[model samples]
Structure formats: C-alpha cells, structure tokens
Target: MTDDDLIARLEQQERDLLFSRFDFADAWRLGSLLVEMATERGLPVAIDIRRGPQQLFHAALAGSTPDNDAWIERKARVVERFGNSSYLVGRRLAAGGRELDASLGVDPARFAAHGGAFPVRVEAAGVVGVVTVSGLPQAEDHALVVEAIERFR
Candidate 1:
C-alpha cells in the first residue's frame, strides 16, 4: 500500500481508540481522585472534571478563588469548541500572535480561553476526558492536571 494508505489506516485506528468507550462518570471519578491526591500532596487546586456535556465532579480546594470557576468554564468551552485541550498550544504556535477565546468561539482568539486544560484518558474506565484547573497561575494550572495524570497512572 502507499504511504497515504498507511497514514489513513493509522488515523482511523487512532479515531477508533479515541472514541471507543468513554463517558462522564469515568471522567468525574478520575477528576475527583486527582483532587484528592493533589490535596494530599499539599497542592492547592481547583478542578473541573467533565465528559462531553456533563460535569461529573468539581472541587475548589481551600484558597482557590471564585474566579477559578470562570476560568474553568472558559477553558471547558474552548475545548468543547475545538475538540482538544492542546488548541491553546496550537494557537500559541500560530505565527500571527492570535489566540483562542471562548467568547469569540473557536476563532483565532481560542488560546486566550483555553490556556488551562488537560486531556485524560482512562483505559480501565474506557473514557477520554479533560481536567481543568484555574485560580493558580496558568503554568501551575496545567501542572496540576499533569500531576493528576501522573497520579492516575
């Protein structure tokens, strides 16, 4: 087969794996577990764990602010619009200095709203989801999700 055929086959395989078996409950459970672990690790965090249109769980640890909720909402909207947490990274890499904004839909401003989201895939639960955190610095918010992924693993 040609290289195009190989690439198409691989892409199909990835899509099959990505959409296989997943939902809100799994996302919620993993998100809650992450929050619990982060608290145990002494990392103050705000978590919004979701799958599709449903929010399975959320927690704003002590010291996390109300504004964290807004950030989480914006981040969630961004991912929902763009279909991935890495949209912000993509927008940042775009040469025009454009960004993504939830308020502006999935346009060039997407980076502004999607700066703090991380995707999580749970094999056991058969779910692909996202864990969003805010209130902390953007890098820290991203780090918390990474830490959660590590702990979940």
Candidate 2:
C-alpha cells in the first residue's frame, strides 16, 4: 500500500484498538495468544508487553534472535515516548516527508519509529502500556500485535 494508505490504516487501528480494561492478567493472555498464533503460523517472533518501565511479558519464539528483542525494546520506546503506535509514528514521519533524525532530536539508537509496538489504551485511562512483536517485516509485525489485541479484547 502507499504510505498515506498505510498511515491511514495505522491511524484507524490506533483509534479502534482500545481496551475497556487492562491489567497484568490481560498482558499474560495477550502474550500467550500472540505466541499461539505465531507458533501456529511458524512465525519466528519476539513478543513484549510493558507498562511504563516495567516489563510485564516477554517471549522469544523459535528462530527469533537477540535482535528481535532489541527491536522490541526500541519500538516500545517509541510507544512510551509518544503514546502512539510505533508504526503510526513512523508513518507520520514519512507522511511529513521527514526522517526520525531530521524531524526529532531524539536519538535513533534509543527509539525506533518502526512498526510493531502499539499502545495499550484503556478507556478513560489513556495509554497505559505497549504491546510489541518483532522479527517479521515492519508492517507484519505491527499487524500481528494488532490481531492479537483484537482477539484478546
């Protein structure tokens, strides 16, 4: 899809994927659901869920590497910093015809404006955490997290 199309889809995703309630138990359920989906599809992925600086769930499936873990961290940083999906942030940068380095003073090494990490927004509570997956293409990684969250909700 075109960049604008992708951005629009991500925007809609951010708006639609809201949880009525989210907690530690919900994190476990979402993580497990993502793992099951990945295992069933033979997808090599790493999953992570976090609230503020506290990591709630983490898993590295078969074929996933340490890089996947690192990607998850960077992507999660984007969500925590901007309170938006990593994909959406990345797309917004592109939509503005800018790069992360040129548009923001933030170090690219610490935060990535890529897909995968999505904010866990609770109604009335706003963004409380991030759920992320790494290993697939950026869009696929983002889609995986979105699908898992949909199922979890």
Candidate 3:
C-alpha cells in the first residue's frame, strides 16, 4: 500500500482499538496471547507490555536476541512518547521524507518509529501503556500485536 494508505489504516486501527480498563491481569492476558500467536505461527518475536515506565509483561521467544529487546524498547518509546502506534508515526515521518531516527537529525538512541509498538488506550483514561513485538518485519510485528489485542478483546 501507499504510505498515505498505510497511515490512514494505522490511524483507524488506533481509533478502533480501545481497552475499557487495562490492568495487570489484562496485560498478562494480552501478552500471553501474543506469545501464543507467535508460537503458533513460528514467529520468533519478543513481546512486551508496560504501563508508562512500569513493565507488566515481557517475553523473548526462541530465536529472538538482545537486538530484538532493544528494538522493543525503542519502538515502545515511540508509542509512549507520541501516544500513537509506532508504525503510524514511522509512516508519517517517512511520507514527509524524514525519520524518527538520526537521519532526521533527531536523537537515534531512544526512540524508534518502526512498526511494532502500539499504545494501550483505555476508555476515558487515554493512552496509558504500550504493547510491543519485535523480530518479524515491522509491519508483521505491528499486525501481530494488533491481532493479539483483537483476540484479547
């Protein structure tokens, strides 16, 4: 899809996906679901769920490495900072001929606008947490997280 098409779809995903209330239990359930889906698909992914700075769940499946963990942290930071899915932010930036990383003259170490992390938006509570996956292609990582969220709902 074109960058604009993808951006529009990602925005819709953000709007349509909402949690009534996301607690520790909810984190566990969603995290576990991501793991299960990844395992079934044989996707070597690293999954993480967090509330602000507090991490609630994390898993690094076989074949995943420290790099995947770093990607998770970076991508998660994008969602946490922008309150938008990392994929959407990346697509928007790319469309403008910029990037979330150093190519845009921005700090490259902490934030990654790649497609993997998603904000956890709760009803009336706003975006409170982040859910992320790494290892697959960025779009696949994004889709996997979205699938788990849908399954959890």
> Candidate 1 clashing pairs?
99-108, 99-109, 99-110, 99-111, 100-109, 100-110, 100-111, 101-109, 101-110
Evaluate residue 61 in candidate 2 and report its C-alpha lDDT on the 0 to 100 scale. Answer: 96
Worst 10 residues of 3 by lDDT: 99-108
Candidate 1 to truth, TM: 0.65
Report the lDDT tens digits of candidate 1 across residue range 28-132: 656788778778877666788777666778888887778778778767665555554543443343434544443344544323444467654444553356678
The sequence of per-residue lDDT tens digits that candidate 2 reaches over residues 1-153 is 988888888889889999998889999999999999999999999999987788999999999999999999889989988899998998998888887773576789889989999999999999999999999999899999999988888
Pairwise lDDT winner, candidates 1 and 2 = 2
Instruction: Give lDDT: candidate 3, residue 67.
Output: 98
lDDT of 3 at 147: 87
Model 3 TM: 0.95
Q: Which sequence of candidate numbers ranks them by lDDT, best first?
A: 3, 2, 1
- Candidate 1: list runs displaced more than 4 Å: 1-20, 90-95, 101-111, 120-128
User: What is the C-alpha lDDT profile of model 3 across 3-39, one tens digit per residue?
Assistant: 8888999999999999999999999999988988989
TM-score of each: 0.65, 0.95, 0.95
Evaluate all candidate structures by whole-model CA lDDT and list the values in order: 0.59, 0.91, 0.91
Best by lDDT: 3
Q: How many clashes show up per model?
A: 9, 0, 0
